[model samples]
Target: MGKSDAFKALIIGGSVGGLAAAHELRSIGAEVAVYERSVGRTQARGAGIVMQPEVEALLANLGLSARSVSVELRERQQLHIRGKAERYRAPQLMTAWDALYRALREPLDDVCYRLDSSLRHVRVEGHDVTAEFPDGHVAQGNFLVGADGIGSATRRLLDATSRPAYAGYVAWRGLEPESAVPEDLLDLLSGRFTFFESSGMQMLCYLVPGANGELEEGSRRVNWVWYVNLAEHDLPRLLAGRSGRQFEHFLPPGELRPEIVEEVTEQADASLAPQFAELVRLSDVFMQPVFDLPPGRILANHAALVGDAAGTVRPHTASGTSKAFGDAAGLAAAMEGWTPRHGLPLRRLEEWEAQRLSHLVRVSEIGIELATRSSLGVPQGDKFFASD
Candidate 1:
């Protein structure tokens, strides 16, 4: 392929990482197209997502500036011991995952995003890559990026041996309207993110501006996530009874076991102070299983993986989005000024892979440690949030 030839870049997935990659590639003049399995305009599928400064920087780089996004910039994060109401603060931001995705998607005008097109297979030969879809459609690109997430089809095509391993826990998340919560609790949760921990279970709560960017009265919403230890065998059964529509992404509201729900409610009622109780009682709960994807490198001709497709860390550090953004930026930077025949700059891919894997390993370690330590009522050190 000639240098002047418009390079066709096919991005498999339209989530945060995939959309960011497409935008970055397009900004640099690549002919970009995204294939998302879900049909229709994407909305907040899961509960909430925390967008750290590093992740925000990538969004700004891709022209999806933070100013236009409706997210609660959490200047501080707090940790609350299970039986104690006292909390300590750390820095972060809280926002809905769907809101973030929509913010990124809105800025792209030239890119073609095809929804309902699930990837069936990727045929890679030399520098040419052909992505086949389940609908009997095929797209050929000079390069292919597998940003399809944890259960990535692109990863499957590139490295069939890769699979997600469970971390022996599940995370339940949900959003509650602020008005439903009492005044005192809203005051405590409104300004900062809060975390609560206990043996075998952990819960977090934070305020996010409502869909309209208002946290006042009935307009604001509070986001909550609960992580609980679960035996691997019981996961499918726990998730099975929910309606198929509700089970599409994370667990839907009010689907967890009544006993577990009652236990959590009772715990929050007893342990959390009046300020924290309102946030918990007003919470519209949802649950999800947490898993850790071990780090591994994928080296092949004309193909690559990024974000959760490459590996995943637990959400404790709130670094998943940042890691995905870093991967997108690094991969885009690696592909600069390259032709199809020349293939991906091997040295560049190597450097990008090394940097990404190192960061992921550190983040994963922190996540595992936090999962164990938070349960012990230990205060998280500030060093965990420092950049490598």
Candidate 2:
């Protein structure tokens, strides 16, 4: 491709991040293609997500909106064992990972979306970059984006030394069907983002759309997360499911190891409030180890990284999706600035990198601070997102 050729942006990974990238690039009149490793639908267990403005803005920009797939929340509460509680009332939007994915992925044309296509590597030669597939299919584009998430192959190829480190805590997460939620407990969790915290541990639950994206009362699901400090050495055994197969990614339901479940149950019973313990006992749970990825070397050799592939944020900041949305917006702006007058637009790319890295640093720093504050019985504070 010549310097004056039409812009062709190849996006790796077709999840929320990559699809968002495609949407932004297409808006700028760039040729876009998304290569996703997963063949069909993809979902994460314990997938309740708190939506942010940036994500909502992107959806608006793409002329797409979440449909029948989210529950609007009105308050945040911290319940005490003595039955007293403190409430922080604010309008919040929560949805499932599946809902967010559907809202973002359904808009793109299928012809340019290559499912079951995994990016094995990328070779940058002169003004163009070539993406190699495992099946030997090669795609050439003017620039490349790595949005394949935390275990990103593009990140590996782009910065060979990047590694995701364990964050010293594991979140035991699950969803309780409104049907399964106890008659008494339903009222407490239904309309609010509720949390219960103890020294070195915290538990929170709030209502979200049901599996079918139902929003009616008694049909919505209550999503819960319990954070505990689990040593890194024990992770290997925990990764093995009842089938004895140690999966690399987060374990899906039924595949969670019985021992880990038992451990969580015991911990909940011993350390958690009675109602919370029962919630833990009845719900099928999944585990995710937290990690802090310092922003480093995201832009290099005609490519950039987005979303978790860029760097993951601890959920405490409630900025994971926002960060991804910001990356997509930044990339769109950078590409649009690449005119003949500016040539390669290297300065825009660098400015984009600086802005994104600063945001990641702020979120990650708050996440680390949250660990210290969890012992104080509040995982996050009002000034949380405001500080950065």
Candidate 3:
């Protein structure tokens, strides 16, 4: 819609995608309200994003400098199990999830964001849409945007058939303070992307802006992710947190069962390089079960899906964050051409869905291929070697 249009947007899930849609839509003159299920600030419970141009664009559009929250690396190195290392010149920017989330959220007005508000139902009547919350509050808008993450309630409400399929592996991730890292390990990992790979597993680490977006030498953090293959039956035990609660997606740091944590430590000591083993031992690690959700129809009448709500490609693509922001941009671009005078942007949404679905499919295929090549045991063919 144009700047002169009277557009009201109701957004579900106030995380990156939701907040991004808020920014993009607002720039085009839409009044936006974001509803988040979390009562307090939402933690991504993950770390380390390879900066993408689209992500940087979103930050730039918000008047934030990417350099303020990112660290630049000059090379990629692979540390072998036997201590031999292979290196390549590859420059990239890395940032922490907390840093990006904080930058995006800080500028959003408190009145436009609602916390402790879980979506109860979505009602669409003619050209208008309404979002009902558990508290019996209803919000009406010209359109509804679903920017929820992988286990999206909005996706369920729109297309019950689309669901996240467990990818038969889990990522053990952690962030260690630079000040706490051993001097030798710190010097070894400081300005390069380091990785180690073995049968059915891969581990990588890089520097990221630390607590509260601090980028100073001693204040930064080393972000690492280890993707390990596991049997489907073992998932239940691994996902069972210390409180005896079974988590569907991930266990926050310190929530992992003590025994599970011990097992992972032992595995690292036994199989990983000495440096990586020590890194794992020193950090408070967390676990995230990987899953892939293929794109279904992302638009239903005046309601639409963005980010993981539409599709979830594997993390191997390193495009999750970029994809989320891209969805918001794509949606905004589509809507920019239409106004309320033309009624609902059904045709416009269809065009956006077509373009987005094609991109999601391509990225998902690339992730599957990368997973197989990295020995994660995925059976996909070498359809492509590109990324989003």
Question: What lDDT tens digits, residue by residue, belong to model 1 across residues 1-388?
Answer: 3447657889988888888788777656677889887787643435667767766786677666554454454445455544345545565556667667766777775578899978998787777889899889899988888887887888887777878877776776668777777776666667676666556666677766676555354676878776666566666655643344424225656666565466556755765444455456556666666666788874457777888888998888787777877888888787777766565688988988898899999998888888887552123311110112
Task: Encode model 2's per-residue lDDT on 183-276: one tens digit a residue.
Answer: 8888777789988887667788888887777788888888998887655666666778888778654776787766667877877787777778
Error of 2 at 164 (Å): 1.0
lDDT (tens digit, per residue) of candidate 3 on 47-122: 9998998899999988787888899899899998865668899998999888988888888865378888788898
Off by over 4 Å in 2: 1-5, 64-69, 82-84, 337-342, 375-388
| Ranking of models by TM-score | 3, 2, 1
**Each candidate's lDDT (Cα)?**
0.70, 0.78, 0.85
- Which has the better TM-score: candidate 1, or candidate 2? 2
Q: Candidate order by lDDT, highest to lowest? A: 3, 2, 1
Best prediction by lDDT: 3
| Candidate 2 displacement at residue 379 in angstroms | 17
Give TM per candidate.
0.84, 0.90, 0.94
Error of 2 at 275 (Å): 1.8
| Alpha-carbon lDDT of model 3 | 0.85
* RMSD list, candidates in order: 5.9, 5.4, 4.4
